[model samples]
Target: MTKMNHKILLGAAITLASLQQASAVPFAPSDARSMGMGGTGVSSAEVASTVQFNPALLATTREDDHFGLKIPQFSLSVADDGGFIDEAEDFDEESELDTTGQGRTNVDLLSDLLDEATGPLGLEKMQQGIEELKAAQLLPNSAPIAKKTAYDNAATKLTQASEFLDTRLYSRNPSVNGEAGLVVYSGAIADDMDDLNNKALRINGGLNVAGAVPSKKFSMAVHAGAQVTFSGKVKIDPKDTDILRNYSAATSAYLLNIDALQLALTNLDENDSSTFDAVDTAQQAVDNFNYGGAGRPESEGNTAIFVDGELSPEAEDADLDSEIQMIGVAVADVGVTASRVFNIKGHDIAFGITPKLQKISIFDYTQELDSEEEFDSEDFSENQEDYSAFNIDLGAAYQFGAEKQWQAGLVIKNLIGDDYESAEYISSNGVGGAVVSISPMMRAGISHRTSWTKVAFDLDITENDPVAFEDPTQYAAIGGELNVWRIVQLRAGYRANLAGSDQDIMTAGIGISPGPVHLDIGVMANTSDIENEAGIALEFGVEF
Candidate 1:
């Protein structure tokens, strides 16, 4: 009834409706080179593109005039079912009674009879309706005209019940029935009401950056990224049929109370009416039906029936759209290494490690109604901060036999402590820790010193522990590559998930090299789910 109670109810309603926000999950890139095949470059000197894979690899940069760029696209979707109510149904029936033939009923007698029927059970039900109406901001004090209109509508239904119940039940039970009849009638009435509501949402965003390594062993770079998310849903859809049923039950209770009161009034006489006070008592009973506040007041009017009235679908939808953006900076190896021999035996190795700092920003806003048309600001702000952590990677490769026909390599990624702490969100403390990959590779089928073509195969084993972050899994990829005219290379591979969702990744890529510049593009496609996902990546590098 007080302003404080009104605000509390409204806040509770908003909390209950805002439960559909979306959360972000971890992601992985499917490109073989990014996955650590030959180590991301034509040679072992640090290049701009390598910074994205392993920062430690940047330490091996031997070239001063080299630069590279990379662009990638990724997407995912999830399907959810079973949870919360979706629909509501309600119905009402009415008839008129000729109370004119009967002597004037004492309103006092009627009030006593109706009170007996409701007792504690009816009062509890009425209180619940009031609570819901208050939460919706539909209380008489908040929306006076709308509140009054709903109250009158409910009262009119009660008036109609006076005629219907008087005609039907008056002849059957002229005396008081036991509490058993009251309970049965009350329950039956509650079952006819209906109420329904529905909701849904969508989110999207992206990141971008530019930087360079100033020297061979030590290099510095700068990066920037942004994210945008939006969500919205509509009610009154066919899915929300349950809401209607609740309404029908509430209306039925109102009518039943009126009928019971009319019967009691009929039992009182005129002389008793002056002293009996049945009509006055009945009026009080009707006023008590206003469940809008803590205690019944004449000014409150009938608030029970309108308690579950319609809500503004648009206003509700906007409230759900707000979410935070996640931004971060990552450092990795960007150098290149070159082979010294053409055949018999050759060796080259490059390593990189990346330490990252991230910031997550979430914005929340609430709406308050003042005089319907006017509004006032509560508290709103854009707060930005950061989270810091580190991850490391080591990569190496060896070539054997004439024409460097055989090659083998090993890579260790995220090889550090698992937990990362930031201002907005704490990454799982269990340590993103480490992932190990071993690639036993081979190249053959070359004729002579002037041969223009060659073929190669790489078998890899990767241990990905998304689990520390609550997602854990292992994967393997078997792939082969072909070179033509010493200018173009084609690659294809099959990858398999060893833990969690058992799915296969089919991948392919192409590489082009002209003089000192090299370009590589790769595509990975998931074939398991109906809404399959495909990932594409591009990498550029130059050899000095």
Candidate 2:
């Protein structure tokens, strides 16, 4: 093997090792034959993977199917900065966290204060503020939550505030230019965490061993495999909007007063006679929003209630959807299958089934993002859950035509429908627990084949009910392949979601089979001004 190839294989081994700790197995394991056909193996199966897609195809009886073995296979599908892979590979971005640490901020003067306000150290300050309020008989009416000490109460509230940010991520990092800057411009850890959540890149891959044995009209195949997948997304939970609005309002007013105080004393605006007037206005604004019960402005002519002035944020945005979301799924499956075919009238029809066992692991992690601790891999399992089940897949395929080259196939996976509980993902937001429904997955396809060419169409007839925090999808796909005397193959196809997803994916693949040894590769991509996504697959095996 070439040095580069050797290194790539070594890296894959290392990754599989790390992923194993998390109990993540590959989600889907596809071979070159099906990859070359745009993921259509139902009625288009030309190889042993019939064990996975349509066991029925395994019963078609192949002249050279006595034994088949796939030593190893790997696939990659990534979007959003290549799921951090590209970033890790690039040397220039290695120091990005350092460069942006605490230096690059709009409010350079308040950077230190910002850190204190939004970090572990700041909990002490918040506690002190509460104690001072109690000393002055200005304690919050909602104080003493859970009968804790002053510092504990303050810390608890602060924690809730952080969770508010965690559950309802802000849309895009707020700029320090207007009302939007209340949370982010301060260099708050909460804001930084939201930014991290938004950059959720997705990565998935796998490893496996599979093959088949054929005997005239009765054939069967058995296989085993594992996969690991990770994905991230960011959203704001509307349920927590009101609580966050209060914090944001009070915080913005306080910070604004400080800025206005500085501006009131500025020489740049000194030429203006209303500098002191602006200062008084800022002071009044701060007091009005201080959450100090039944208070009035210190200014002689100012009042807390203004008939018309800037107002606090509404209870929620027009869209109540949360602002940030992320999910990681690790699942493994092992199965044994069998199939049989019968000739009736002028058509050959086949039936197949596979019973399997699956184990799924879940992680529901929430952390003080933007902290040094967040960078440590050891902390990844702060929130995790696991589940296991047994299932079965059933498939049927029919071929009718003078030459029996026309075919139709159907398959149902997870036929019994297994429900795996997700980690309890709760904050101020409403219940969005991690429960996943391992519902039935149904697929169908039709195809026509000749000695040198094949054409096919496939589609998802029912949605693969969500097992994570993601949208449901249904797809329509069409593909074609050209073969050169079973020695070389060229393939291409297009697949799109019909369930209102912005998906327009294109696929292509090539395969070379020199007798018993075969090699194949496939590519898939969908890019737009807003998103760029792509995937590739490679498999090697021998057929006899």
Candidate 3:
């Protein structure tokens, strides 16, 4: 049970847990079409899947189908590099222990101990040693005394070392690491490190919008939908007693071979390891000295009764729970549009433009430690309310040739430069630090229809831009979709952050229609990791 073995086990466990949680979704429109390019209807009545992608596209829906739903499985992965130092330390410690064992006088005993420990070498060396010992008849089946003795002694020491190393490597860092700014660290450090490194999930839901729109040429739709996001959080309290800061410090020092402290801790006999004990006791004392009035007595009728019956001013406990709140509408979108057809050289060309308004409300709660009171604030207040923003979408389709067999269209989305502003309380007023996004999108698709099947190909691209709170530059998505039989769709594409980080996505979806009801299911996968996503959408409409 060397540190190396413990770390290897921990790493495997983290990797497996992450794989089990991987899930995916289309972060862009092309992703949706990869499942199936079926949104080209003639009226809003048949445009029921997640309507947010393109409000104007609703006009393409068939007139008879009136309602729709889209439930997509969602997941994500996020990773950070700060915590790997501890894992590396575990590796280094194990290596040192192995070297130390080689220097021992009794190599056989060392080998026996290694065999009992759950590690790479333990299993391999143990098997080899056992075979050799058996071949030499050093201990026959009837004379197991020497063999048993060797096995037990080795097993005991290995077990102890393994247990100690496991506790040290996987446990949370009791003392905060790095500078105390922005990101906070807590929770099971090993697992939390893995969690923060990556995130993936699946969300499913659908949209129901009826009586919200009028016709294909000019209409509006209001959709109601629900989304469940799957993710993980690391909850850590710096006050946990199990966290040994000096142990963390020792491990850190061990990593650097700074032996002053280690030599001091080792010189004392096992019974006099009071230095470590004193360190733990001092930490507990500091943790219990709550300056935040958490455990202080409160005034009853303006009178305070002290523990010793001495009168003192009563202090109220901080309200930890009331600092958070939730309030907001589920879903809403408004739009106005106009469209017309014109004859150009006897060819029919249809074009349209849509103006849209979008509004969002978000609630947040956070506690700031009040050093004077040794507690946190309990007050909760309105955190974010973003004002509406106006965006325009334009599209045009041209029919070609005598039979009008060839058709192509272009769509430009989010044409306006409206920097949606965050609520005053949560504003990021820095240069180029705006809340709204102006994504200029371009999409083109061609479809061929025969008696038995319908096939289509689509390509979509949106330029990248960075958000205020995130990295300075991140790109929108670019992807393609393939559809067949009007029922099956396949998608694939590559997305890259403006910073140059990239990942690939793939997806498949199926559509089933029965009279006025329609059901769509889609699954997505990512190439960079084991992330995947699945979604189901339903719509009810009539063909006019």
Best by TM-score: 2
Candidate 1 vs. true structure, TM-score: 0.42
Cα lDDT tens digits, model 1, 279-334, are 34554454454222225343332222223222223211212222112222122222
Off by over 4 Å in 2: 1-28, 80-201, 236-326, 344-346, 370-372, 375-382, 423-432, 527-531
Model 3 TM:
0.45
The C-alpha lDDT values of all candidates are 0.34, 0.54, 0.34
Total clashing pairs in model 3 = 56
The runs of at least 3 residues in candidate 1 whose Cα sits more than 4 Å from the true structure, single-residue gaps closed, are: 1-157, 160-383, 387-391, 398-406, 422-473, 486-489, 502-504, 511-519, 530-532, 540-544
lDDT of 2 by residue, 1-544 (tens): 0000111111111121111111212224556556556667777866566777787877764556676667666677765432333322331122233335644333232233333444543334333433432342233324433222332344344344443333222222344322233344323322322333323356667666787785546776777876666655443232223223343444334444434433433322323435435544643553444331134433311212221222222211112223323456766778888888877685568888899898877655443111123223553465566778898989898877887778899988778775454464433232554544566778899999988989988888886533233334576778899999989999988776676355567788998989988888988777341245578888888787
- Can you give the lDDT of residue 461 in candidate 1? 47
Q: What TM-score does each of the candidates earn?
A: 0.42, 0.63, 0.45
- In terms of lDDT, the best-performing candidate is 2
